[model samples]
Target: MAVRYIPYYPDTLEGQARLDNFVRTSRMLFYKDNNQVKTRIQRGMPLYEVTESETVGANPDGNIVMHGECLSTCAYLKDKGIEIDLVYIDPPFASGADYAKKIYVRRNPLVQKAINEAEQQLDNSDMQEFEEKMYGDIWDKEHYLNWMYENLMAIKSVMSDTASIYVHLDYHIGHYVKILMDEIFGEENFRNEIVWCYYGPGSPGMRNFNRKHDTIFWYSKSEDYQFNDKDIRIPHDAKTLDNFKKGLDGSGFISENYDLDQNGKIPEDWWEMAIAGRFPKDGVKRVDYATEKPWALLERIINASSNEGMLVADFFGGSGVAAAVAHKLGRKFVHNDVNINSIQTARDRLVSAGAEFTMMEVRDGVRLFRNPVQTMEKLVRLIPGLNTETNLDKRFWAGSIYDSQKGKMPVYLPNLMDSSSRVMDKTEMNHIIREALPDLGNDVKQIVVYYIDVEDIEELRQFIHDENTQTDIAIELRDLKQVLDDVVIEDKATWEMSQVQVELFTKWQIKMLTFHSDYVMKKIEAFNLIGDQQHQKKLANNKKSTFKPIKISDEGLECIEWLSVDCTNAQKDAPWHSDAEVKIDKTGTVTVNGTKTRNLWDATIQSDDKPLRLKVRNICGDEVLFVL
Candidate 1:
C-alpha cells in the first residue's frame, strides 16, 4: 500500500514564510510526503516491460515509454542514472476542466446500408458519440500545489547539469506555479516566459477580451545549457529581405552592418501556432487525443533546446507529440503517462513514424486498472449479490450484500479514481477498526473490505487479530483482483489463415471475417437508454423528436480501431513483436505498418512469418490478445 503523507500547503502568511524559508535552506519545497516519495526517488519504482513492441530503425541506446505517475516515473529514471537533456511537461493546469477523448465508431466503407425499417423501429434509441474522461484536472489549490511540488523536485533530480525544462500552463493558475518554479529551479536560472498565441471564434455574449493563449515557462538547470541559436531562427519576411538588400534601414529596426545569421532572425519569446484540432479538419498534423499540442510547436522547442543525439523527456505526455517529434529529429525520448489512451495513442504515433521504444508499466498491481474510473463504475454489477442497500454508515460502507449464512454484510471499496485510496495500508486498516466499526449498526453481522494492492497480507491479518472490537461482528478482507479477473468482456473474433499467391510469391495471409465487442455493445445500450429518456422528455413538451439510436454497420468492423499480428512468439508475458499491423484513425483512414493506406480496411494482412497471435484494440483503447 502507498504510504500516506500530507503535503505542507502554505495557507497563511506564517505558513508561506515557513515554506519559503524551507526552500531557501533546503533548496526544496515542503512536502510532508517527501520522505515517502524520496525513498522511491533514492531507490526506484519497480518497472517491468509489458512488450518490446518495436526495434526497427530505433536508437541503439533505446527509448522508453512508461505508464505511471510522474513522480514515480522520475524516481525510476533517477535511480537508473539516466540524465535527460531536454524536458517538456504539459501537466494538469488545475483549471477545473476534466478533459475527455472523443471516441468515434470506425466507419466501414465496404458495408452497404441496411434498409430494414422493422429492425430500426424496434430499437428507437440512438447511440450518440461519447466522450471518455481521460483524467480529472479539478483539485483544491493546496492539494494541487503539493502534488506539483513533489513532481518538480523529482523531475529536477533526473535532469542533467546542462539540461533545460519547459513548464507549460495557462492563465488559470500559471501565476502561482511561476513562483514555485522560481523556488525549485532557482531565480538565476529563470529564462524566458514564452507566450503561445492562437485564435478561434469568440463567445456570443458580451465580455472582456478572449483568453486565447498559453504560457510556457522555460528554465535552465545551470548557467551553461544547450541552445541551438542558429537552428531555431525564423525566416525574414519579404519586406525585411528587400530592405537589407537595398541598403535601406528596416524601419529603424535595422542599423548599418546589423548582420543576423544568414538562415533567419532570432524569433521573439512569443509564438503563433494553433492548437491541435484547430486545423482544417486535421491537415495531417492533428491527432484526435484531447489537448494534443501541434507537431510544429514541439518541433520548434526541440530544435531550439537540445542537440540531435541528446535525450528528450516528457513526464506528463498526453498525446506524445513531444516524443514523436524527438524521435523524428534523431533524438532518443522517454514518454510517460498514466492514461492508457495517452500511452496507446503516443505508441501508435511513434510506430507510424517507424520509431521503436520499450513499453513498460510501474507494476502497481493494477494490470487491468489502466482506466480505473470506468472499471469502478462497472464494479457495482460485476460483484455478486452486491447492492447499494447498506444500512450501516455510508462513509465507510460503499454497499452491502446479503448472504444466507452470513446475513447482511457491508462492503468497503477504495475509490479507484484516486491513486492514494486504491491501496490498503496500516493507517487505512486502523481507521476501519476505529472509525468505521463504531459507526456500524447493530444489524450488521459482517463487513467486507476490498483492496487493489496491500502492504503485507500477513501483517494485515495479524493486525486484525491483535485489535479487539466491542461487538462480535466479523470483518473479512478480499483481493479485488480475484473478483475482477474476468472484468474485461473479451471481444470475439473469427479469422482464416492460408497461403495466397501474390505476384508469384506464396505468402501467408490472415483475413478477419467477423468481430464483436460485448463491452462496446453494452456501452451503446447505455447511450440508447439516455437517448430514450431525452426523447420522451421532448415529446412530453410537445416538441417533435427524431431520435434514432446509433447503429453499427452490417460488417461490424466499426468497433475496431487497431489490429496487429505478433509473429515473433506466443509468449504472452513478453513484449509483443508485431509482424504486421493496421490502425484506423478518427477519419477512418487506414494505416498499415507505419504507412498510409487506402481509406478502408482491407480486412486482411500479409506477413512473411507465420502468425502466432493477434492483438485487437477497440475504439476505446481497451485491447484483447487472442492466440491465432
Candidate 2:
C-alpha cells in the first residue's frame, strides 16, 4: 500500500504552524451529508436565473452570457447536469494594473442647461460621472494562487471527462500556476504549453527583456479528448511550398511522391498572432476593452478543440471574444465574469453580431448579510453586556467579546468569502485560534467560536483539546443564528419612471424621445466595492475626485450612462440596429450619434407605429430594455 504526497509551501514560521494545524484537524470538517453542508454554506448567496426580457428561448441551440462569479456559476451548471466540452479561460495575470473604460452618456439640451445652472449654484462641487472600472489584476502572491486554485477546482467539476481546457497567463505568476494545474489535472495529462507571441507599441524597458508573449497551458480531463487538426491547418510558406514534389493526384504536391495537398502544415506550440487593436476606420474586430484578444486567436482554439453544437465556455470572458467566435462557428457557449462591465460589453457585442443568447445574473442582494464581522457588530449593538475588541492578526474576528461570567472570550466567525459553498473545517479554526491565542495571554481558560453551520462540533472540540493538552482551555461552539434573530436589510435600488415619452419634432421632422429613471444609478456602488484595502482605497479616491453621485430629479433625467435604440421593424430574427447612442467618456467629453456635443445630445428619429426597442445601460452596467 502506498500513499500520495501533496506539495505545498509556507514561507514563514507562522505560515508553517498554520499549515500543520490545518492538516491535523482536517478530519473533523468532513460531513456525511454533503448536500446539507452545501446548503448551509450557500444559504445567503444569490441564486442565478435567466432574465425574462433577455431570454431567447426560441433559439434552442444558442449561447449564454452569465453575469456572476464563475465559481458559483460553474457549480450551478454542474447541478443542472450540463457538462462543458471545451474551456478557455484568460483570467487576471496579477499584473498589478487598474483597468478602466471610458463610458459616454447622452445628454439633452434641456438636461445640459439644468446641469450647467446647478453646477454654477453649487460652486462647481458636482462633476459628471462617466468612467467605469473593469477589474483589477493586483494580488498578493499567496492570495492570488489560492483564488486561482478554488476557481480552477470549481471549473474542473463542470468539464466533461473528454473535455480540454486552455489556461492563459503571463510572465508574473504563470510558472507558479503551472505547478497548480499539473497537480489538479495530473502531470501525465499535460498537453502543450502554447506560446502566443505578439508585437505592440510600448516603451522599451532598460532593465529587462521586453515582454511580448503570453503562455497558454493546455490540459485534458482524460486521455481521450476531442481534437480536429485539419480544421486549424495554415498555409505553407514559399520555402516549404518550393520543396514539394509533383504528386500523382491532379494539381497536388507531395514530399515523397505521396498525394498531399498544398495546404499549410499544422501550427507548432509557438504561434504568431497579433492582439486586437483599435482601427476605427478599417473594419477590424476591436472593441474599447483594454485586454481584448483577437478573434483569430480564439477561433483557432475553438476550432481545434471542439465541434459544432458542443458547449464551449470562457469563465474569464474579458470582451466576449470567445463567445463571439463560438457563436460565429455554430457552437453553443457559456460566458461568465464577475465584472459588470464585461457583462454589458459582451451582451452588446453578441447581440449586435446576431447571437441568440439569454442574459443572467446571480441575485446579489444577499451578499450584504454574509459578512461575519458586520453581522457580529449588529449583534453586539442589539445585545447588552457584550463588549467586543478588535484583533489585528485574525481576518474574520468581530473581536473577542467580554461577558462578565465568561471573562475574556475570543470569538471566531466564519463566512462564505467567495462563490464556493464549502464550509470552514477544524483545521482552519485551529489556525485562526492559534494566531489569536498569544494576544489573549496564556492564562485564558475558555474560548467561544460561532459558525453558521458545521459538520460536527464535538469532533472539532475533541481535536482542539487534543492539540492543547499542555493548557486547559475549553472550546465551545455557538450557532450564528442565535445572533441574527429576525433582522433584515431592504434592497437599496429605487425607480421613478413608469413609461417612456416619445414626441414628434415637427421642425426637424423626426421623433424625439425622453427617458427617465431615478434607479439608474442604484448599482453603481457595486463596482467600487471590490478587492483588498489598497484596491478599495484607490477606487474610493477615484470616485471622490473624479465623479459624484447623480442626484435624483423628477423634472430632469440623471444617472443614465449609455442608451441604444433599435428601429428595426421586423419582430423576429431582425438584427438590432443602432439608431442612435449617447455616452460620456472618461474626460467628461459628451458624444452623441458619433459626434462630439457641447454637453448635450441632438437626437432625431422618425415616428413609426412599429414598436421601438430601447436599451438603457447605467454606469455600473445594469441595463433595462423597454418597448414603446
Candidate 3:
C-alpha cells in the first residue's frame, strides 16, 4: 500500500487552498543497476553478516538495521519465512515535532559519555561516521510519520495468524497514528489503549494538565492472539498474601497480612513499574538515546505474548533495548530503524550478548534485518550452483559436484565448450571428481554415474569416462532426470571411456568454464584482492580489510566490463585475450585460459571520420565560438 499520513491531506480548507504555497519537494529513489551497498560497510564495523555458524550453541541469530529507513519488519520476516508472533513498535513521539537528543562529545558531558560508550562498542568505522552524522539531528514529525508509515505497511504482512502489535507513543501524535493503525490493521483488531502511568515532576506548561504517562495501543492481526498472562503476572500484594494467615490456621507468618497463591497474581492493565531513573539498582540505564523504554518493560510484553522460537519484530527498534530483551529471553528478533545511529547502538548491544545479524535495504531505502545463516542457506537452495563446499558457509564459486558412487552432476555449471587436443583430461577432471566425491568408505567397490542434465546426458556420460579411462571402472549411467519417466540413456558401446565420450566431454567442459569464468574470478578475487581508488582506500581503512569484489556473473559482466573499459581503457583496443578474464573446462580438466582481441576504443575511433564539436553559450546572450 502507498504510504498514508495526515500530512498527505490538508487539515483544513484554508490549508488545502494554500497547499500550492507549500514547498514542492520530491525525493526520488533510483534503483541502480549496480549493487555496491554503499551505506554500511566500513573498517571496525561489526561483521554482522553470518559468514560462519557457531559450532557450539552459544550464539543465536538476530536481525539489526542501521542507517537506512525501515518500512516493515514483518515483511522482512515474511520474506525469510519467520512468522512473527508479536510486534512491539515504539515509534517516534510526534509531540508537534519529532525530538532526538544529541549524543556527541560536543554536547553535554553526560551525552558525551553515552556517545563514547556507543563508539567503543561499534567495530565498523563507516558506521561510526554515520552515527556522527545523525548525532544531534532531529526529524520533523511529518517526516517521522512518512517514515513510520512506509515501514509499518511492510511489517503488517509478516505477522502470523495469532500475532499481536503493540505501539508505544506519547501524547504527541499518539491518537493520530492510532487512527492510521486502526484503519490499516482494522479497527476490530484493536485490543487496548494501555495507559502507562507514572508520577513525576510536572512540566512547566501550567495552562494544561501535566502529562506523566504514555499510551500503548495494543492490537492483534486476528482475534486469536498469543497472550500468556501468567508470564507477565506480578507478585501478590503484601496485604493479599497475608489473607491466607487469617484464613488458614498454620499459614506462615511471611504471608501474615495477605492472601498467597502458588501462582502469582495477574498484573492489572494499569500496572506500574519503576520508571526511568527510579528503576531497580540492577536495571540498566538508557543513557545514550533518550526516551528508551526499560528492558523489564519490554520483557513483560515479550514474555506475555511470544513463544520461545517465535519471531518478535520491532520496527522502531530505538536503542535496541527490546531486541536485547528478546535475545535474553531466547526469542528471535527482527529489529529495524531508519536512523543509522540507532541500529549501530542496537547492534553493539546485541553482539555483546552473543547474537549475529544481517542487514539489507528495501526498495524505499529502509534498512531491514535477517539471520545471516538462514539467508545464506535459502540462497543456496534457490540457486543450485551456489554450493558452499570449501567454506561450507561461504558464498559459492562456480564448480561442479561429483559423486564417486553416483558420478558427477553439474547444476547451473558454467558453459565452457571448447575443442582442444592437448587439453589435460585425467588431471583436471580427476581434481574435480576428487573434490566433488563425498567421502564414502574406502572399501566401497561399486560405482555409478548421476548426470543432472535433461538436454546433454550423453555429453556428461562421455565427460565422466574421458577422465577415468582404462581404470577397470564398472559404471552404471543414470541419465539426468527430474522424474523416472524423464530418463534417457543413450546406447553407448561401453560404460568405460571412448573417443566420442572424450571429445564430447572436452567441448562440454569448455562451455561450462566460459559461462562462469568472470563470476568465479570475481568471487575468488573478492576474498583475495583489493580495489585501487581513493574511495576504496577510505573503505579499506574503515573496514580494516579490502572490500570483497562484488559478484560480476556472466549476466552482469557485459555491463561491468563495458563501464570498466570505457572509462579506463578508452585509448587501448578493447582487449579480450586475458586468461584471467575466462575459465575453461575441457576433456575432464579445468583451466583458466583465453585470448584477448584488440578492437576500436570508441565510436569516434571505430568510425575514422567522426568529428567532435563543442559549443558555448554566453551568459550575456552572446554565443561563443564552436570548435569541431
Highest-TM-score candidate: 1
Candidate RMSDs in Å, in order, are: 6.3, 10.8, 29.0
* lDDT by residue for model 2 (1-628), tens: 0011111111111211121122334443221233332332333222344232355434587467886677657756765678899999998888888677654333344555665678743222344444555555656665566667656766787889899999999999887778767756776778999999999666766676678999999999889998898899988876555555434344355435554455667799998887863322422256678789888788899999999999999998988989988888889999887776777678766755667777776543332232222333356654444445554345545556666676766666554334332334565665555665555666566777766544466777777777755445666777655556555432122222233355642211122344444323433333333323446577778853332343444432334556655555334334445555555433334545445555543333322323366556554454555554
Report every candidate's CA lDDT.
0.74, 0.60, 0.43
- Write the number of the candidate with greater lDDT, choosing between 1 and 3: 1
Candidate with best lDDT = 1
Collision pairs in model 1 = 51-575, 52-575, 125-549, 126-548, 126-549, 127-550
Per-residue alpha-carbon lDDT of candidate 3 for residues 514-562, written as tens digits (9 for 90 to 100):
1123222433453334344544778757855444333333322111111
> Model 2: which ten-residue window has the lowest total lDDT?
1-10
| Order by lDDT, highest first | 1, 2, 3
Stretches of model 2 off by over 4 angstroms after superposition: 1-53, 103-133, 201-205, 245-260, 277-285, 363-365, 368-391, 394-417, 420-427, 440-558, 563-616, 622-628
Deviation in Å, model 3, residue 183 alpha carbon: 2.8
Tens digits of lDDT, candidate 1, 1-628: 3332222212221222333345555466544433433343333333322334444443475799888777557656765678899999998888998788877876653541231323332121322367677777776665566567667766787889999999999998787678777777777788899999988888899498988999999999889988898888889889877777776654644676677457988889999987752322322355777788888788888999999989999999988889988987889999999889998888888887777788877665565544655566567777899998646576677788999988888888886644545557666777788778877668778889999877688898888878835667788998887778866567888888998988978878888777888777877777778989999999999999967776776557778889888888787765677888888765566888888874456577778788898888888787888887
TM-score of 3: 0.42
